[model samples]
Target: MRAVIADGKGGPEVLKVVDLPVPKPGPGQLLIKVRAAGVNRADVMQRQGLYDPPDGNAVLGLEVSGEVAGHGPGVTAPPIGTKVVALVASGGYSEYVAAPAGQVAPAPEGVDLVDAGGIIEVAATVWSNVFMIGQLQKGQSFLLHGGASGIGTMALQLARVAGARIATTVGSDSKVKIARALGADLVINYREEAFEEVLADHGFVPDLILDVVGAAYLRRNVEILGVGGRLVVIGLQGGQLGEMPIGNLLYKQGSVHATSLRARTLEEKRSIVRATTDALWPLLASGTVRPVIAHRHRLAEVSEAHRAIEDPEHIGKELLVVH
Candidate 1:
């Protein structure tokens, strides 16, 4: 099997296509012939040596969609030949990835396998952080950072459909229009505008904030949170540390939560995936939740895929067709 392997840690230059032995499933795992793999910020981080994959796994894809080529002990739900999307601990950037059965779920019936692969991680993160941790409700307002991103676009639409009002912050002016197209009620251009001021200008004190840029927005986010609000941090694109006002957080009755799907325990990720498949699949099946795949790359052009994602001009999910 051909896989994009990383040499030590560096930039996209570190990624190289090399032939490797096809991985086999261990206990309670499934050997999937990967059709598509989702490239994420974590993959870039892993490539740059900021984050490392777990023991015995050097590959770095958090989500995949493919066919079950084989299975191991105790695996039963998704039988052979079942088209499915799955979350894996690592190694999804290869032609074959062995995933634990617990972390895999049947893909939406009508979704193309190539596109279906890109949906798992985005949907998993959204379901867990927004609806579960944030406790977003109808008529309540939620603020999302990076509103035009693959996860951002999906999050905005899901939040609106789930009955919550949505607002988003973007780095570009064009993305504001794109954000609105996807259902965000207010789009603040953070390049030339202060998100805190813009939201307050509109009388929007968000009850929940789904933030991707963590440390950079910390103080402002804390300032914009209404009483008893929850701020969930999904990414640390903006530096990872900052001096925050603990007194204000206590006085304002707010909580800060940081979550990552990749490093979660197996059972935890499984439950998240199962819930996503159960609640989110029907929406995709009925066209209520549509995937926003922006670009697809051949298995060998993984370097280019990384470049495009980092370029900021490429919006939506970037997919690698491995099989």
Candidate 2:
């Protein structure tokens, strides 16, 4: 089988596709014949030597849409040849991958199978952080950073369906309009204005914020939180370290949480998968929310896919056709 790996770590140039023995599933795992895989920021970070796979595997993808070619010991239900999408700890950028059965779900009805490759990771992340952890409720205000991003786009749509008052920050004016069209009640072009100030001026105090910018916006995020607000930090594209505004947090009775889906345990991931499938599949089936694909590249063009993900103008998910 062919798989993508970072030869060393520096840039997208380091990524190379090489031949590798196909993996057989272990107990409770499913052997997935990869069709397409999602290209994520974490994959870029891994290539740049910033992030390491939890399982110490060098393969560079996190999610794939494929078929259950076979099952491992103790796994049976999904059955052979079932079309599915899976969230894996590593090794998604390959012709085949072994994923824990619990982390796999039937591809949503009505979505193209290849496009479904990009759906699971973002859906699981948003469901776990925004809905399950942040507990965003109907009528509450929600704010998301990187409005045009894969995670941002998913968060916006889910929050909209949840009946929340949605706000988002994007890098360009065109993305601002796209965010608005995606049901965001407020969209700020961060290149032109500070999101905190714009949101405040609009009197939109978010009860919940899904942030990817990390340290760059921490203080401002806290300052703008509504009473008893929850802020979940899931990415650190800006930087890793930041000073917490203890006084402001105390005054507003706010809470801050930082989490990463890639670092979570299999049990936790399984639970997230179950919840995400149950809550999001119907929405996807009905076209209430969808995976936004900004670019699709063949497996051999992995370097180009990585570069596309790092482009600021890129909106939505990047996918690698593996089949």
Error of 2 at 93 (Å): 0.4
Tens digits of lDDT, candidate 2, 1-323:
99999999898999999999999899999999999999998898898889999899999899999999988999887888999999998999999999999999998997999999999999999999999999999999999999899998999999999999999999998798789988899999989998988987899999999999899999999999999999999999889999889999999999999999999999999999999999999998999988899888999999999899898888999999999
| lDDT by residue (tens digit), candidate 1, 213-302 | 989989888878899999999898999996678888899999999988877888898888888888889999998878888899997888
User: Model 1 segments beyond 4 Å from truth?
Assistant: none
The 0-to-1 C-alpha lDDT of every candidate, in the order given, reads: 0.87, 0.93
- Among residues 3 or more apart in sequence or in different chains, the pairs in candidate 1 whose N, CA or C atoms overlap within 3 Å are none
Per-candidate TM equals 0.97, 0.99
Candidate 1: lDDT of 115? 94
Superposition TM-score, candidate 2 onto the true structure: 0.99
lDDT of 2: 0.93
Considering summed lDDT, which 10 consecutive residues are worst modelled in model 2? 173-182
